[model samples]
Target: MTLPIVTAVDQAHAAPLRALIDGKAKPLGALGRLEDLAIQLGLIADGPPPTFERALLLVFAGDHGMTADGVSSYPASVTQAMVATFLAEKASANALAKAVRAELRVVDAGVDADLPAHPKLLDEKVRRGSRNAAVEPALTPEEVAEALERGVRIAREAAAEGFELLALGEMGIGNTASAALIMHRLAPAPLVECVGRGAGQDDEGLARKLAVLERAAARSAATDPLAVLAEFGGLEIAMMAGAVIGAASARIPVLVDGFIVSAAALAAIRIDPAVKDYCVFCHRSAERGHQRMLQSLEVEPFLDLGLRLGEGTGALLALPIMRAASRLLSDVASLDDVLNGRL
Candidate 1:
């Protein structure tokens, strides 16, 4: 697969951006994480006061056959159910998307059920659903390639529609299982370290989930990013990785949601390390493995309300924060301006 080239944010711009931020009409570092966020956003925009004409949250939906193995407390049907909820503007993500005035589009990546036509849903299903990873590779290399290509295309389409802020989120039953395994290989961490109580799992459920993942892990020794992804494939995750690469290639900022979405980010970062600079780890998911995912990437997330929702809900909440930080460039005044009474 030919990966997109993401040029790292020019360090040449970092110092000047920081100077501008420091010179803002406020105490040094008074903004705290907001300042850091502004700098990152500035670098992504390749200027101070990073601005995007529009923001779009791509909520990719799919199903995992592994859910049949009791990895999650919810049934696999919930993936399709949640997609409907999202389209009906009844999901938590929908409310938050509206709150931030962001457009939310639900894409069917590989949902098992044949979803009905919906104006809000984008039909980009690569397959009915990924194969059960515990028994065999969830996706062949070809399927992985197709999903990635589609993701890139989707992101490019959003960018073409004047969306500079691209956020990624996912809805897949038992997806946490897929993400944990992906992290196990990509992060090169112990399997236990990568496992988590997804969607509120009881102690017994967590153990059962871990056992199923162990079975899947033993089936592959793959450490390559794409290899691991195919082995423990979640179609939505693969597509999101492609979107991440595409966003970086376009020099746009990608606001990444929690665990499953972060797995895609990790995979994309592995494929192209430079892509990290363009990514905004938007939320700190309550999912335990999410911590390891962030630590492995050596990045800090912007918001942490102990949210474990995975439909880009956290990302929706983060959109306003991102907007405010980006506006620091044009909204706030420099100390010189304040002192000189330029305003």
Candidate 2:
């Protein structure tokens, strides 16, 4: 199915947005990034800055074929285990979401194991797991399509449930490798530039990971991006791309988490550049490739916390800042009111 082409917020919306921010008692543009964020929020909401009442953090969990090459310090089984941890509210994503009062949705996008029935888990597995790209394609074209559709469906459902903002997260053990591959191919950069030491991999392991990605890149050199994603993209990445598109089409603000989510955003932008308008980079991750990805997208995140955790932690951390932006835009008194000296 053809995904909807997300349209940009109209220029007409800018005047009202600027009025909302500038009417505040603070000197014009005195709020700095907060003022800019208010404008972006108003544009995304297509009205006065919106109150983010309900937000959802969707964490797509999956496993990668590249794990077999000993690229990651953790085993492939950690993917399933982390899904359970997320369900148990023990994972960092869950903790951060809880701290921010954002609802969490854990999806089995393509976990290797049979996940036991759970109330919070959304079972939408596209495959048992991706194939090791070092040996062959990660997923078939059909599987990629299904994963993308699953993400769109989830985003629509979240919107229907009254979520004003959608936050993207992921939980696949070897996903960083897949992200590196995607970034290397999509960005105007080489594989070595996009590759990073993920999950504390030692120098030797990082070298092996790079070698596997180099081989995968060479084998898939002739393929287009969609074909390459089908051949090598992780289920979670494909789903996150779909969610970004869906959120953009729905005109809801999307808080991008970290490197993996940024990589997915890059893929979505490749499919449709308009999707970038709805996205807000939450932070600059500690991972080396994150800065390159950010530069390629031409987005400045709200924070640079030196964080590398990828489970929407950055997005959750930015929640307060977003709230502050909206509050300042809507609640601050006008300079005219202050100057009248009515009191």
Candidate 3:
């Protein structure tokens, strides 16, 4: 597949952004990571004046047949239910997006059940549900390719609609299991470490999840990002990876939520390393392997609310801070003006 071209973040703007940040009427680096965020937002604007004028959160939903193997404590039906809730504007992503004034868009990348037509939902289902990875490859190469194309189209459409930022979220019942496997191969971390208590797994449950993932892993030795995505069984994940590449190609910054979204970002970065430059790690998820995932990306997330939920909650929470960071560029008074009694 021909992936979209995503350029690395422009470094030419970094020095200017740093100077602007330091010139603010505050101690050097007093804002700490906020300064880093401002610089990143500025660089994403291609050295032009940065603006977080509008932001949109894209929550991609799917179902996993791997749940048949008991990898998750929850039933796959919950995926369909949550998609309905999101459409009703009552899901966590909906509330958080509203709280931060970011638009929310839910996409049905792939869910096992038939869903009612909703004006708000994007019908981009690649399949009802992925094939059980334990038995065989989850998605065919063509399915993966189509999912990616849809992702790119969705993100670019958002850009055209005038959203300045893109935030990612997911709602697949056993997606964390899929994410673990994706991270395991791409991070090259031991499978044991990548496995986590997705949606609250107990000791026995965690062990079972581990064993199930192990068997799935044994079925393939592919390390390529696209190959790994096809091997794993989550259409939402594959679509999110495409969205990441799409957002980067559009020269827009992306606020990545915890583990699952991060896994998608990982695959995206591997597909085109330049995509890394446009991603903004939102927070550290309480999910066990999230730290290693962030470590592998060499990024420090902004919040650590001990959140394990995966509806782009962390990303929405971080949006306000990013907006504030962008304001520092045009809202705050520079030291030159302050020292000259120019207020």
Candidate 4:
């Protein structure tokens, strides 16, 4: 199936943006990455003074069949439990989102447990959970397609509500195993090299996790993006990829979260190369394979806080920095004007 055509972020204003920044009273590029961020937001807005009046964080929660393979420290039940935490505003991402003043919404993508309805929760469950990727395909093609469409629809809905900035996040037990296998498939990295200590795995658990991922990778060696997703990705990951695509098509900047979100970004990029232009990787995850994924994308993240939490906490943490970029670009005075006694 043809993915949605995303509009490439317009770089027509790059020179003027640099001029605008350089003319500021501060030293040239003194603000460092923040300045680059300002320029990027300007580019995404296609001109000066980008407005980030409303930012929305979507946390997609799912369950992985690989959890049965002794991969994660936690059980699949934790996925639904954390969804409750998100609704209660008791999770790290909740506090972080509040601190950044961005609204957070949780989506039940494919959690195995039954989650009650809530105002803060969106019901878009594609299935009870994905199948065991180590033994079989994670999801059938039809299921994967539905999950992707769910993500695209969510993104478009957020955009329609006047949200200009978006953040992607996920919650799924054993998702790292699925992510590792997906990375192995798409990045074609050594399967062992792709494995990481997900949610605090022990040495033996990590080894077992690695073995499970290897079998999953070998079982699903498809190169096509959707095929890879169906072969090894969770419902949350597939939806996030679609959300990235939908956000790009809507010309909204997406603050990509940690390892799982970045993996989803890679899938989206594979679908449409222009998606990269619309993304700002929030941070480099402490997860082992994240740096490799970022390297493959040829993109540098905004922060490296050694964050391994996967509830969009890293992305929300970067929101203020993004806002500061816009604030400085729109409000900072030029040296020329200051010299003319207009200060």
- Candidate 1 C-alpha lDDT tens digits along 1-343: 6766789988788788889889999999999998888888888877654465488999999899899899999999899889989999999988888888889999999999899999889999999999999999999999999999899888988888789789888999899999999999998689998899998899999999999999999999999999998999999999999999998998889999999999999999999999999888888998988888899999998889999988988887888888888888778999999999998
Error of 2 at 252 (Å): 0.8
Ten residues in sequence with the least summed lDDT for candidate 1: 44-53
lDDT of 2: 0.86
Candidates 2 and 3 compared: the better one by TM-score is: 3
CA deviation > 4 Å runs, candidate 2:
341-343
Please list all clashing residue pairs in model 2, or write none if there are none: 65-132
The global Cα lDDT (0 to 1) of model 3 is: 0.91
The C-alpha lDDT values of all candidates are 0.90, 0.86, 0.91, 0.88
- Model 3 compared with the native: what TM-score? 0.98
Model 4 clashing residue pairs (backbone): none
Best by lDDT: 3
- How much is 286 displaced in model 1, in angstroms? 1.1
lDDT of 2 by residue, 188-298 (tens): 577898888888889998898899888888777733557767777799999998899898888888999999999888888887888888899999999878998999888
TM-score of 1: 0.97
Give candidates' CA RMSD values in order.
Answer: 1.2, 1.4, 1.1, 1.2
TM-score of each: 0.97, 0.96, 0.98, 0.97
* Residue-by-residue lDDT tens digits, candidate 4, 1-343: 4567788866777888889899999888899888888988888878764567699999999999989988898988999889999999999999888888999999999999888989999999999999998899999999988988888889988999899889988999999888887777777677777789989999999988988887787785598988999999699999999899988888889999999998898888987899898899989899989998888888999889999989998999888888899988889999999989898
- Candidate no. 2 TM-score: 0.96
**Model 3: colliding residue pairs:** none
TM-score of 4: 0.97
Please name the candidate that would achieve the greatest TM-score relative to the true structure: 3
